[model samples]
Target: MKKQKATIHDIAEKLKITASTVSRALNDNPRISEATKKKVLKIAKQLNYQPNHIASALRSGKSRLIGVIVPTANRNFFSSVIRGIEEIANSLNYKIIISQSYDEFDKEVQTVEALLNARVDGIIASIGKATENFDHFEKIMNKGIPLVLFDRISNELEVSQVVIDDYLGAYQTVDHLIQNGCKRIVHFTSTQRINIYKERKRGYEDALKDHGLTVDPELIVYSNMQLEDGRKKMEEILKKKISFDGVFSASDYAIMGAMQVLKEHGYKIPEQVKLAGFGNEPFTSFTEPAITTVDQKSIPMGKITAETFFELLNSPNTDTVAKKTILKPELIIRDSSK
Candidate 1:
């Protein structure tokens, strides 16, 4: 016959104490003396006792786990943010569960529900490009679980958000191009569904207006932030007989797209048409003519998001209030924009 398993009652009986005393000592409650706490922990260890995580979490209503939802973990920006979150979580004795939405709304909703089932203490997310509905996030709010949004966020949602100033970053890029004698400037962006794209577009327009230049709607082009999409859109712009001396793309990938097509067509970069991009992605520096771009402080953004999440957890009173944090993005000048 197998030996009987030792329960908290057994330990309490052995120590000649009540079960409540044993439980309080095991939990290191201040009411319990340090000697009693140490004795209980030592006996529990000797018995190889393991606390039930689910039962304890149910009692305290905290899983001490954070769930992170990103569009794609493959991208450098998202990866850096993950690193930041990991660093903070580990230091705080918490764990992280990550899921990729693949920029799909349905997948994002599913991911959130899965996290909820796991009873995560908090969630950090970057809304997917295809996410127009936020009922899924509403569930988290209704359940009183803390939520933090970074990079891509919903304008309608009331929650703590961490983001860079895309508008200022774009405005400065276009202004720099204008200063470099780029008169016929063309702006390349994505669909206005996301705030980042909309803000960047607004910045580009504002810069042009500041110089007393009227923004020609025809000069503004939209395409998905993909190399092939960039190439195709550039080809369409070329077919329209549009003459542009400068190009500002919302992403580095798009910069490469326009550059590759222009180079094949014998258009000298910085000579015929200068180019500027965003994200300051690694590849931007190695391109034929290094791409000028914006640095969104991706790593720091992640770290801050993690730190902010904990701050919210510690301050329950302020958790319900909306907190907006805007980090400044720096412009990195390179050969692409001369």
Candidate 2:
């Protein structure tokens, strides 16, 4: 059997008021008195009345929905950022749809297209590693849709974005290792053209130069910064007879893998080899020897990203310049680098 859906007329009939008055009360219009609003809402709930957002959007031309995209939601950093975005969006009576790219360029393009098709009010995204082309992002700007990016962002697009101080974080970590009597430090970075990795790699090189150490070509390993990639790269370095006393990776997962291989090779952490990584993942603290790393400040990043998107959406001037917000990173010294 099919059940009939309740509408404003049903509530009006129950309260003996006009349908127009019921509508104003449900919308919390100032013309409706608080007493009338309470009664209308009570009966509305009793009747299981559900507002049709799609119809409302068609009338108002505003969906009040924000779409968020990330590389992968499985990471603690990405999930924490989503939570922060949700906290602000919910308070503003806006809903968010989350999509993951899974580090695939094709999937990222498809997700953007789907979100646009759904007519989201705005979008917030962290670019995937496999994304090199900017056509999809350019399309969003071409349509004058508000787009805000965070963390793994690209400078190719003239959109607002939020990011942490990757260069400063990497410099601080490498400098700390140097202060602790490490000279032959190995740097694990990515081959991708992403700004985050580029900045971190530049920081590593500058730190080595500042401390009077030559940048050893053999010690610089490039990869996707995954755990298995770290293990394979470390083994390759060992096979080539490269001697490195310290390791600083752009990712905690990669550093973790490197740690495993070093242990299997009978190398003592912070004794024969010092280790540090970026992104303070939870497991970093629970390892055999807690890893020293940099905190990305995911919660605040998410909140600020969502706030920036709303600001752009509300700005009267459509020609407003894009804003870039950079937050400071914190370096946490743990037993692994001591």
Model 2 Cα lDDT, one tens digit per residue, 1-338: 99999998999999999998997898899999999999999999999999766666766788888989999999999999999999999999999999999989999999999998888888899998888898999999899899999999999889999999999999999999999999999999985578899999999999999999999988889998999999999999888889889999999999999999999999999899999999999999999899999999999999999999989999998888999999999999999999
lDDT of 1: 0.90
User: CA lDDT of each candidate?
Assistant: 0.90, 0.93
The model with the greatest TM-score is 2
Backbone clash pairs for candidate 2 read none
Badly placed stretches (over 4 Å) of model 2 are 1-23, 33-49
Kindly report which residue stretches of model 1 are placed more than 4 angstroms away from their true locations once superposed: 1-56
The per-residue C-alpha lDDT of model 2 at residue 59 equals 63
TM for every model, in the order presented, reads 0.85, 0.91
Error of 1 at 211 (Å): 0.6
